[model samples]
Target: MSGVGKSTVLRELGLRGLEVVDTDDPGWIEVVDGEPLWRLPRVTSLLDRPRDRPVVVQGTVANQGALYHRFDAVVLLTAPRAVVLQRIRSRTTNSYGKAPAELARIEQDLRDVEPLLRAGATHVVDTSAPLPEVVLAVERIARGA
Candidate 1:
């Protein structure tokens, strides 16, 4: 997760006033102003409000239907299986007593999301690029800048 540029891009955008949400933050599951609420009702309710504002949510693609309709665009970051495995190995802090199995699960998750992306929820930005390049690409998309 650290090797991926999700947090990087989201932070950059947030610094520019975009309301950024990273589901990896435990607080995301709690109700709080300006923080992400993972529950469908809360997220949808926030989306329904009228505002001349921007929001960037970087979350694992698991249980995605909860926020699917809430977003105007979805940027699914894709990386090769081996690349992701390497990333996990280098970055995950706790192995949960089964590193190999956890790596397998991550690979499976990437495979599963490929279809949703193919079906076209929105844009899919490949994070395999260099960090700056990836950030620039996401910025351009975020602002149409």
Candidate 2:
């Protein structure tokens, strides 16, 4: 989930004049033992912001039950294991799943956590597609298509 292009899609949306927030932004993330954790209150505060357009908040923190009802729509972005691994290797912003232990944890999440998130998602998009296409899909979902 860390490398599923959530941030990239949010950036594309921002360029197209949409309001967006990536929860992984500085001050909203806390690293614990080299693994990133969401600063829940900060994230909730950001989500509470008023916006004229649909504000897209992207992250893998959707599993937090308390935050579920706050979202009008939940879009889960998924990719195959190979693609996820590749993206993780290429990413430079955060060192997620880089170490052996983290990689194992990420693998476990792929098998366990992702499906639970998927079950609760209002919409699901495959990130193996082109970035623009993925952004378009997210936009459509955000607009309640």
Candidate 3:
């Protein structure tokens, strides 16, 4: 999610009239409704009693099979390792993880998450191109527009 621009694409879709659910924000935590909740257990309760809405959920977290099963589709974004490293470098100047080890750890996380992408994700977006291109790809995948 950090390197992938999932939220950016989702926001673009929202602008085009697609209702979206961004679980990356903490506020989503307050809205859980049902059983077999989202990967975040609290979200399960939210699902049990969901509000009247058409939404696409997006986030990166461990153990999300529950949400994965519930969603009509899942989008996983990935970019070339060098591009991702550059993105992290350019965008995270003010972050606490500015040191070499921290950056290395972030790259490691990306590598470690690769298997999960292969195993669980339904659609994978290769985000090595421009943002608009990535958003366009996701829009096609999610909105078919």
Candidate 4:
């Protein structure tokens, strides 16, 4: 999940003129009862608006299942565990996965959280593919091609 190409693909999509929302932003998440959930009102308002182009949203949180139905497609990007760890360790774009504690959490999420996401997902992409190919696949999905 962490090392999957969500951010990378998202950037490419944006450059290609797709509307993209990265929900990892603070405004999109709210903490309630010590659990993180998407701020439903904000998300709903965004999704409700009429749009000329497809909007691709990217994020993962404990309560994302609650908002799955609001999306055109729920896509899960995944890579092998070792690949994820390696990327996490070396990635320069984000510093999240470098810490040992965060790494542990990622390992645990891979086991516990990913399966749930997979089950809820309408589509799954193995991000081990070449980066351009991965970007093209996601672009096709966003373009409804």
**TM-score against truth, every candidate:** 0.72, 0.82, 0.74, 0.95
Over 1-145, each residue of candidate 2 has an lDDT whose tens digit, in order, gives 7677777888898887778877766776777777666777886887787777887887765335567788888888999999999999888987877999998978988999999989988889999999989999998877767
Highest-lDDT candidate: 4
lDDT of 3 by residue, 1-145 (tens): 4655665677887886667777766654332443222346556665566555446677666557657776667778887778776776676433523678887766777778676765798888888877788777776766544
Candidate 1 segments exceeding 4 Å error: 1-3, 27-37, 49-52, 61-63, 92-98
Q: Return whichever of 1 and 2 wins on lDDT.
A: 2
Q: Tens-digit lDDT track for model 1 on 74-130?
A: 676666666666666665553531467766655655667566664655777777888
Candidate 4 C-alpha lDDT tens digits along 24-107? 877999999988788888988999999999999998988788888888789999998988888888899899878889999899
- Identify the superior model by TM-score, candidate 3 or candidate 4: 4
Candidate 3 regions exceeding 4 Å error are 28-42, 45-54, 92-97
Higher-TM-score candidate of 1 and 4: 4
Output the better candidate (2/3) by lDDT. 2
Alpha-carbon shift of residue 108 in model 3 (angstroms): 1.5
Model 2, residue 38: displacement in angstroms?
5.0
lDDT of residue 57 for candidate 1: 69
